[model samples]
Target: MRNNEMHEAGQGVLEDGHGRRFYYLRLSVTDACNFRCDYCLPEGYRARAGEAAPLSVAEAATAMRAFARLGTRKVRLSGGEPSLRADLPDIIAAARNTPGIRRVAVTSNGYKLPKVIDEWRRSGLDQLNISIDSLDAAEFARITGHDCLPRIRTGIDRALELGVQTKVNAVLLSDGATERLQQFLDWLRDTPVTLRFIELMQTGDNRDYFASNHLRGDTIERQLIESGWQLLPRAIDAGPAREYAHPDYRGSIGLITPYSRDFCQSCNRLRVSAQGKLHLCLFADAGLDLREEIRRGDVAALAERIQTLVGGKAASHYLQQGQTGATRNLSVIGG
Candidate 1:
């Protein structure tokens, strides 16, 4: 977009009282996930009775346009599994078609990438983030209740071949972490992908799981530095991960340490739920509904509501206070 248009669109609402400017949006396409991950949905996803259907392709596109007008440069399509949505390619095209949006990304469980990744790339996908919690086949099955590691690996390879920027997200657990980290590092030595180790976060429904599996990423960061892995400078639009690189390794490592002090100070993203609710924070008490404006096809009203709601965003989430407000599980908002 032209500088003048960006100036007008940003009319100062995208920046909060804390002076943070949001340039990224994580938009969930659905809350229903197929994987029965131990940390997220141990019993698997069951649709909530009477819950509104997820935003349609047009609705999602409208919301993206509104955010694009408000200076959002990147949009990441997320879900319990975004690939589960049949119109995912349309959503990807929508983001790519937006004037101000420069990148379109998706986060999925990689269950269907082998079959649909090529189509996704043809539809204008620029980046991919797939969940691969464990490299060990048996452990992967134990964690995700799916014995499809080989298939997922094939999908990752295809993504690499397609020249898409790909990243793997792994939830770091305390159980045998040393061995797990070794496996990850060994794989990264020859794989040209970014492997991110996300510290297990506490949620409303995972107190016991959190207490048992949560691992501090700070220790991992220190280890990386000691082992000659150089920390890379974060870009302005980067996500929460602190990335590192090593000369001997083909791929890189990223540590997402949400519990660290001042973790939210550099926040630069907002979330929109599948039902068209603007979430100020992943752990916010509730979201501001924008379905009405979206349904009316009123971009101005949608943007206005988003700006108004964003102005009241808290300085930081209260996860440090041992409170997970509205998020009952990671799948709820595609965390």
Candidate 2:
């Protein structure tokens, strides 16, 4: 069969009968992080054994091309901080130039974004999602365990000034962070950036932090309503985040309730770690390695392996109360 014919046949269902429509590929370009955020890294976190090496730019692009050939589009490059990757613009350009890729984006902590926002825009980056939990400078520093709020603020403004679509991702912890949420919303009311509130996921080495600072999405929505913020309906894509618009605000709000209400049923994304593991679910313990196969010039075999992996995807991750398993970190999985 022709390449398009093979790709179409691989669509709708995997080889083992799992539907494969709407493939979202998240590629982690690196594992090195600058900030030691309490929610993500805590005070004295150490990398797990054999979790150091990151994929090279060439390998990342090759894997993206292979996946693109298999009907996988909508790629997002993430990392401990994707902006830290030196050749990130090159990687973005490669994915954007790849056939079958409809969307290309990046999620960064926004420290070094100001310097490269124009370069990234020129490289075909469609959207930029920066993690900014608190508007208070001190609170933001405490949350991230770093003094880079000014850089982050500048990066956000620069992205907006360059006419790049931007989204600010804030994780709502139970440390009386609602006020900070309101502060961020108030500041963003005049800007074009969309504010997204993420309910902290209970995975990775930061489980203890999540346990101590867990906040639900319902409480957040109630607080926003009580603050006279009317949530207007807005159309969003098939992502985990539920988006809302406010009448008195120019920007929008997005709630990602992965804990309160998991959207795994409609999950169309697959995460590839920097070390080359294909994770079917975010909370999965193990994954298939496609790096070696792809390097060996076995594109058809790699495609078949991806199909098998997708077919084996669970209806929902088994994240029950008091369950213990070895799950990859969100930073490594590019969430």
Best TM-score among the predictions, by candidate number = 1
**Whole-model lDDT for model 1 versus the true structure?**
0.90
Q: State which candidate has the highest lDDT.
A: 1
Q: Residues 1-335, candidate 2, lDDT per residue (tens digit)?
A: 56764553324333223443546678888766787777776653457785647777777777776677666757888887888788999999988877767778899988888898989999999888999888888988887887888888898888888788889888888887758776877786798778889887777576777789988887887777786766555322235676776777888787888655456655767788888888777787776788787566665677767776777776666665633234645666666
- What TM-score should be assigned to candidate 2? 0.88
Residue lDDT tens for model 1, 1-335 = 58755643434338888999999999999999999998999999999999889999999988988887788888999998998888899999988887778889999999999999999999999999999998999999999999999999999999999999999999989998899899999999999999999989898888999998889999888999999999899987789999999999999999998899988998999999999898899999998889999998877778888888888999888788897889989997889
Spell out the clash pairs found in candidate 2.
none
Q: Rate the local accuracy (lDDT) of all candidates.
A: 0.90, 0.75
lDDT score of residue 276 within candidate 1? 88
Give the Å shift of residue 312 in candidate 1: 0.4
